[model samples]
Target chain A: MMQEPQQAREAFRGGLRVPTSGCCPGWTQANLISLPREFAYDFLLFAQRNPKSCPVLDVTEPGETSASIFAGDLRTDLPAYTVYDHGEPIGQRTDVTDLWRDDLVSFLIGCSFTFEAALLDAAVPVRHLETGSNVPMFRTDRECRPAGGLAGPMVVSMRPIPAERVADAVRVTSRYPAVHGAPVHIGAPESLGITDLRSPDFGDPVRVEHGEVPIFWACGVTPQAAVMRSRPPFAIAHSPGHMAITDARDSDFLVP
Target chain B: MMQEPQQAREAFRGGLRVPTSGCCPGWTQANLISLPREFAYDFLLFAQRNPKSCPVLDVTEPGETSASIFAGDLRTDLPAYTVYDHGEPIGQRTDVTDLWRDDLVSFLIGCSFTFEAALLDAAVPVRHLETGSNVPMFRTDRECRPAGGLAGPMVVSMRPIPAERVADAVRVTSRYPAVHGAPVHIGAPESLGITDLRSPDFGDPVRVEHGEVPIFWACGVTPQAAVMRSRPPFAIAHSPGHMAITDARDSDFLVP
Candidate 1:
């Protein structure tokens, strides 16, 4: 009796409050962003300019509930939503029905979850998935290409891949440009201004064995950082790790 | 001693008015779109939803003439621009200096010129380039996914590739997703509602040899068609085959 939309509805109604990382094996997951109609253009332009950091998966018309890839309403479908006001986290709630407005626009962005499945299938180790912890992320010295009023330093997520298999990792991930694509930096933490891999800005660090190297990819958290820095009047995003599950298959994002 | 910007400046000043197909080797070429600030969000959303047909390369801030990729002013840099009013072409001019406004936003989209070079470099024959004619284009029965206020049938350009070399052609073009990446259809023209290979809705039809299969790619003209169909009060686009050249190389758009 639990069909796709029904399952999502269950999550919307508070029957499911867990992180969506491995919840649905083959479905695509998306990072969420919501803002007033006045600021949607600037936010979208920022994503267009810095595509690697903010690879937009789908966008909704102002005040519209559903998106191109998902059937459920945007306001309450996700398990949790974080509201931000003037760059400060106001609160987290199971539903935003009270906050929904006629002038709000929603944006769904590609998440690393889509490519992690590809990496796992290729036998490339996803350290965080194996350890049951979040992927380690860092704030880098590199500045994302700015657009409109949004501007900030690029943030990246790191995974340890065997040195010999690094080429294979690049090849496999390159096929999925929708999901942050390939590694931005390979084997050099110093280049990205991350001096100590043990101390990350976000998430827990994983082990890097003798034959492995740290590979960094542009993270979806980037737009969040930009929103925090720019401090628009109001904004909303899915709580990290609790993403919006879409009907699109993982293979749909791949290129030749 | 002429540099990259100098070439486009000369074109802006009326020294170059020909089709930009083979103008500067190795550089990137882009489709151009300009509109009032209010419609910018909708057009960008349309491009995002129907990426294959409208692969956005770069977008400019409102009232800004230069974009991230191009160094010259968009108002007069391109050799020719077409002005549209209520979905009808009103005039074609060498420059739109007199029509410049403080609220117009310019968009630079990826053109097929980038991938055509890759195809030729791989020794794949381009019939249009060889025969001195425009690539054959058609308006298909296929409808692009609607976004905001823009909606239209997807337009595609056809190239007859030798049956044996079809895979090679696909491999070469698939690397350039920034441009229209791979063929959306192959072999059967009827599948796309085209009854005659000898006739096309736009551009001249090229000869299809006995062993060649007609491969179709999503065309840059699609956004133009969508804009016209949407009937925005005002719009500006580059004249067909007259593109905005950029400093970025074609290889810059290629994935691993």
Candidate 2:
């Protein structure tokens, strides 16, 4: 069995530079967002206001690459990094050691992977995971509360749950509030301004079989969407589906 | 019955300068902290790390007094304000409008009052509340995980719960993680370095009856303790027990 910290250490040594999905079972996986010191507070406040979309797991002080909560190095532990310049992707690299700066701050945000684990444990079928494709993500018409220079539409990931099991899906996911808990929308995609479920703005669309209702949960990609719209001078984020596996158990975040 | 926002507006009009306990029956109350732009990031990081002590409810951008989640003018809506200089409280004020600066960032943190309500609802007796005295707060040997320039001993408030009902108290309070959540210490104050159950570092002490266990929870005063220890050039906070009444319901913060 692969140990959690060992996996991160392997990634740090450049041996594991692939997506972190399915690594460190029962622990949380987090999305990474890095920005300059000047924009750090704004992004933090944005996450606070839009908690459903951006549940912050941990934050690093400016010039600090170590995450105290997750207990890992930000610069090298993750398998991949994507750097953006003025809202546009400049490049992707295996390690961000060359781009590290004293003015930079990083955030570890909760990913939907934890909730998917809960759904599966509760016997709620997760379509994308079953089909071996990326979960479909869409930009919603709902406007997120703006914070300083960051603002955009709420982004959601959809899963088609059997109509009889939607309540179970909601109940199981609601226990993990730190990982984008509960369904934000159910049974209606057009209300969120999604024109077609077959063609999503991100990820692959899965089958919405008969007797199933499409349920959407707030997505961690919401921050990336906000950053792309706001276009700070410099920013770094984990590539899509590449997350930082944390040592914290999914049960650790569950509320009574 | 006085409405929640109306009560806050009364304080804004300079007519209500009393503790906010029992003022808004169902709404959440928040502790206020205002710091300069330079120290804002550090305090935010500090709160993010010690969540049980400082669960952030809302944060304002630099120079902004309005909180979107809690909703109010940070300058005058609170019943009282305390100004600290280099970690020393020099004065108390009804309004900080004249002292407001372009670089100040305000943070609203979760108050223990929310979870106390939960305890009461669960048929658990809150000793201090029953005695109509301020909750007994003590500084512990436990060091908060330091963030940037902020670090200090974790401060906790003690409650005397009957041994038979301690589990019920924990189960009820754990539902509100935005508040202090569950007890950090139970039955033994000595383990937390408290020698006298009748003496506390802050607030009034209450009696521990026979068959009752002294339960401890991380307190909001923890940030004040850290701020005092750090000694920043300037800081502003709500006077203890005088909180900002929020529009959010205590139920809104409850988890499954």
Candidate 3:
């Protein structure tokens, strides 16, 4: 039932601060955002324009608490939830059971973790999992198209792929367009405006061996950056690493 | 080069009344909605949920005038315009050159005429086009989930598919997701809540042969119906027959 995260979120609602990954297997997860209805068009437009970084999965009808088109229950599906108001974290809730509103619309975006499983399946080393650290993600100078007030630079997650398996990395991951698709930048960190592999704007750093080079894929965090820049009167997003679990599988998103 | 609609809109703005379709081919076109930002989330969720009816090709950032994303000068993109305020058509304008607003968000939706062209390429006969009449459409009993406050039934366009060639008919049309990919209700009209094929809620009726079955596909009119049911304070949709032609080629939307 993928109940660990659900239980954790239940506890988180009571108060828990922890990243939830590998906690739910086979249950597809999502990046969460709840904002006033006024921002829906711009946010959806922004996500459409910048799909690699923000592949929208399902958008809940405004005022509708449950994602009727996607699944039956969103409140109990995720392990926990984080609330943001006026562009700042208010607090974490296991269930948004209390904060639900009729004027708010929720957006579920595809996450990079979907493809990470594919990488591991293809025999690609996911150092973050092996070393117990989050995948290194860097902020790039590449400017995403500014939609309305939502505007910001792109953010990318990096994984060190062995030189010999680099082509395999692209071939394997390209099959999954719903989860960031293929690499936006590979081999050179500086090309993507990254100065060093040791330091990442978000997430913990992982090792890059002499034979391995950093490969970057667009991250779900990009639109969150845009939301932050716009500083809407109210906005919400998933906590850095916590995500909403869903029923979708890796094969569901494969482009081919 | 695409100045006919511009001239027509100019005439309408200067004061003219006429329908717009085939006025300009090599031009980008769209359904115009000028609503308060509050309805943004529901409308977006509605469109996302009902893509075949509201297959969004482009959505402008919030509180903006021209559809900078897909349409450059919506001022003269089409030959005529309909301004609706609270589910009622206000007046006809050739060019909404003066009606632009920062609070208005424009959306470009895929028109089925594109698929008719594709069908023509495959030698499929388009009955409505042959008879110089609109394709027959009916209101189905199936209800679309209310996004925000927008809620209504699904509307479908019906075509008489020769029983022998139903497979070919499905194959030829299913490729274009942009133009309402595939038929939703293949044979039975009653099953879709449509009782009669000779009379339709919208569009002109056509004859069905002895061996032909009435096939139903989701119609673009579904959005207009949803808009009408919701009765937003203000909205603008493409006039029933007039469609916005896009820069995209039909082949691009063809599914393998």
The lDDT values for all models are 0.83, 0.83, 0.70
What shift in Å separates residue A196 of candidate 2 from its native position after superposition? 1.9
**Which pairs clash inside model 1?**
none
Interface RMSD of each: 1.2, 1.1, 3.7
Runs with alpha carbons beyond 4 Å of true place in candidate 1: A1-15, B1-12, B195-199
DockQ of 2: 0.73
Give stretches of model 2 more than 4 Å off.
A1-5, A8-19, A62-66, A69-79, B1-3, B8-17, B63-66, B69-73, B94-98
In the order shown, the candidates' Cα RMSDs to the true structure are 2.8, 2.5, 5.0
Candidate 2 lDDT by residue in tens digits, B215-239 = 9988888888888899998999987
Docking class of 2: medium
Q: Can you give the DockQ of every candidate in the order shown?
A: 0.68, 0.73, 0.23
TM-score of 3: 0.76
Candidate 1 lDDT over residue span A1-256, tens digit each: 2225448656666646655655566778888888889888888889998889899998888888888787777778887878989878798877888988888898898888778878888888888887877778888999988777788888898899999889999999888889899888998899888999998786687898899999998988787788888898888888766678887888888888
Angstrom error of the Cα, residue B251, model 3: value is 6.0
Writing each residue's lDDT as its tens digit, candidate 1 over B91-157 gives 8888888988878888888888778878888899999888877678888889998877889888888
